[model samples]
Target: MANRLTPQQQEFYRENGYLVVEGVLSREEALAYRDEMHALAERLRAQRTVNATWPSIRAKNPNVHIDHCHDVQFHSAMVSRLIVDERFTGLAEGILGPNVQLHHTKMFIKPPAKGAPFPMHQDYPYFPHEKHTMMAAIFYFDDCPIEKGCFRVIPGSHKLGPLEHQSPADHYLPEDKYRLEDALPLPGKAGDVIFFNYLTIHGSGQNESSEARTTLLVQMRDPTDCPTVQTHESRGQGMMLAGIDPNARIRPVWEKE
Candidate 1:
C-alpha cells in the first residue's frame, strides 16, 4: 500500500487526534461491503434480533433505531478480510505502530430520519488499555454529509487523556455538555476512511438524510496492552490481524473468533 502518510500527514494526526484518508476503498469495493451488510442485517431482522439502542442520547425522542452488528469480523468473512487488509494495517501502523492486533469490528448502520445521534464521548473510556494504543478506523460505505450526521471531532482532544464523561451513566457525555466551538465536521464519501485516536472527543448529529449512514469500525491495539475492563464477550480480542500478541494467553473466546 503506497498510502503511507507523509510526515506532514502523520504530524497532522498527532496534533489533531484524527485524520481522514479519502478513497481508501474503491466505490465498487465499498458497495460490495454494503451489499453484504444489508443482507446480513435483513437476516438478523428475520431472526428477530434487536439492535442496541441509545437510551438517552436523543434530544427529541426515545427508542430510536441505531443499528449495529458487533464483532462483525466473526460473522462475516468479507468484514474479516477488511479488518486485516493491508491498507488499514498501514494506517494503523502510521499512527499506533507496526505491530497491531485486531480488537474487534462493528458495523454502524444509522437509518434515515429516526436514527439517533451518538453523544460526545471518548472511545478510550469504554476500552481503556494499559498504554492507550487503541485506535479506530471507520470506513464509510455511503456518502456522509452533514445531513447524515458526519463525524464531529475536537482537535487534540486525545491529549486531554479522557475527561469526565458522565451523561448516561457509564457511557457518554451529552453533546450539549460542551460548547464545541472548535469541533471539525468530517463529511465523507463512499470509500473514505477516518482513523482516530481512542481518547479523541467525538460524536455525530442526527441523521437527516433519506439513506442510511453506514460505517465499518475496526478497532486495533498494540498486543502488549489489554483492556482495563472487557465490555463485550470478546471486546479485547479476536484473531490477531497483524503482529504477535506479546501478552498472549489461552482464552476460549479467542479461539471462537
Candidate 2:
C-alpha cells in the first residue's frame, strides 16, 4: 500500500502548506452522499416544530444544523465507517502516518445567494492544539466553482506560521505585505478531495449561484494534542470513530464500578 504522494503534491504541501488532491470521489458517490444528507435533514426537520426562521429553533434544536451539513462527519454515524474505507483511510495513513485521531468534522453549506464568507484563519486557532498537529481533508460533495464559494487558499502561506487574525475584517496576523491577489481557487467536480496542512490559511467566498456549494471538512490530529471537546453547538458534536471517542475526556462514562 503505497501512500507516497506525488512529488509535486509533496512539494506543494511542504512549501505552500496545502495540497489539492482532486477527483478522489466519483459523481455517483458524491450524489449518494448528497442524497443521504437530504434524508438526514428531513429527519431533523421532522423531529422539530420550530420553523427555520425562529431564533429559538437553533437554540432548542441544535441538531438540525448538524443534520443538514452534508459533510457526513457532523451527524451521520456512518462517516467513521466510510472514512475507514481504503479510498480515504489509506490516504490518511500515508499522509499523516500511523498515529492519528479524527479531531473534528464540519460541513460548509453555502446555499444559493450570498452566505457569509468563512473568516480566514488557521484551523488550529479555533481549537487547542500544539502547533501544526493536524491535517485537513476537505471533500467536495458537489462541483465547486468560484461563483459558488469555492475554497481559496494562500499558497506557501503555511510556512509563515500561524497568523494574528483580526475581527471585523478577517485578515491574517502580521498582515502579509502582499494581499491575497495570488490565492488560488481549488476547482473540482463532485468527488474531488483536497488535502491541506492544518496551518494552511484558507477561506471561502460568498456564494453567488442558484445552487449550494457543500463540502465536508475532516481534520485529523496527532494523538498527542488530544483535541479539546467543543461545547459550542455550531462547532459540531462528534461521534465515535473506530471504537474510540476522538473527543473523549480522560474519564470514562460515569457508569463505572
lDDT value for model 2: 0.60
List the global CA lDDT of all models: 0.78, 0.60
Put down candidate 1 lDDT per residue, 1-257, tens digits, no spaces.
Answer: 63577788899999988899999899999988888888878877887755555666543577567778888876788987887788777777777666777777888888899777776788876777778878888999988998888888988989989777775343676556653334678999999999898998888777888999888988877777666765544653656776666665676333444
In terms of lDDT, which candidate is strongest? 1
Error of 2 at 170 (Å): 8.5
Clash list (residue pairs), candidate 2? 16-156, 164-173
Which ranges in model 2 have alpha carbons more than 4 Å from their true place? 1-4, 45-74, 168-182, 226-257
Residue pairs with backbone atoms closer than 3 Å in model 1 (clashes)? none
What's the count of clashing pairs in each model shown? 0, 2
Model 1 TM-score is 0.90
RMSD from true fold, candidate 1: 2.8
For candidate 2, report its TM-score: 0.73
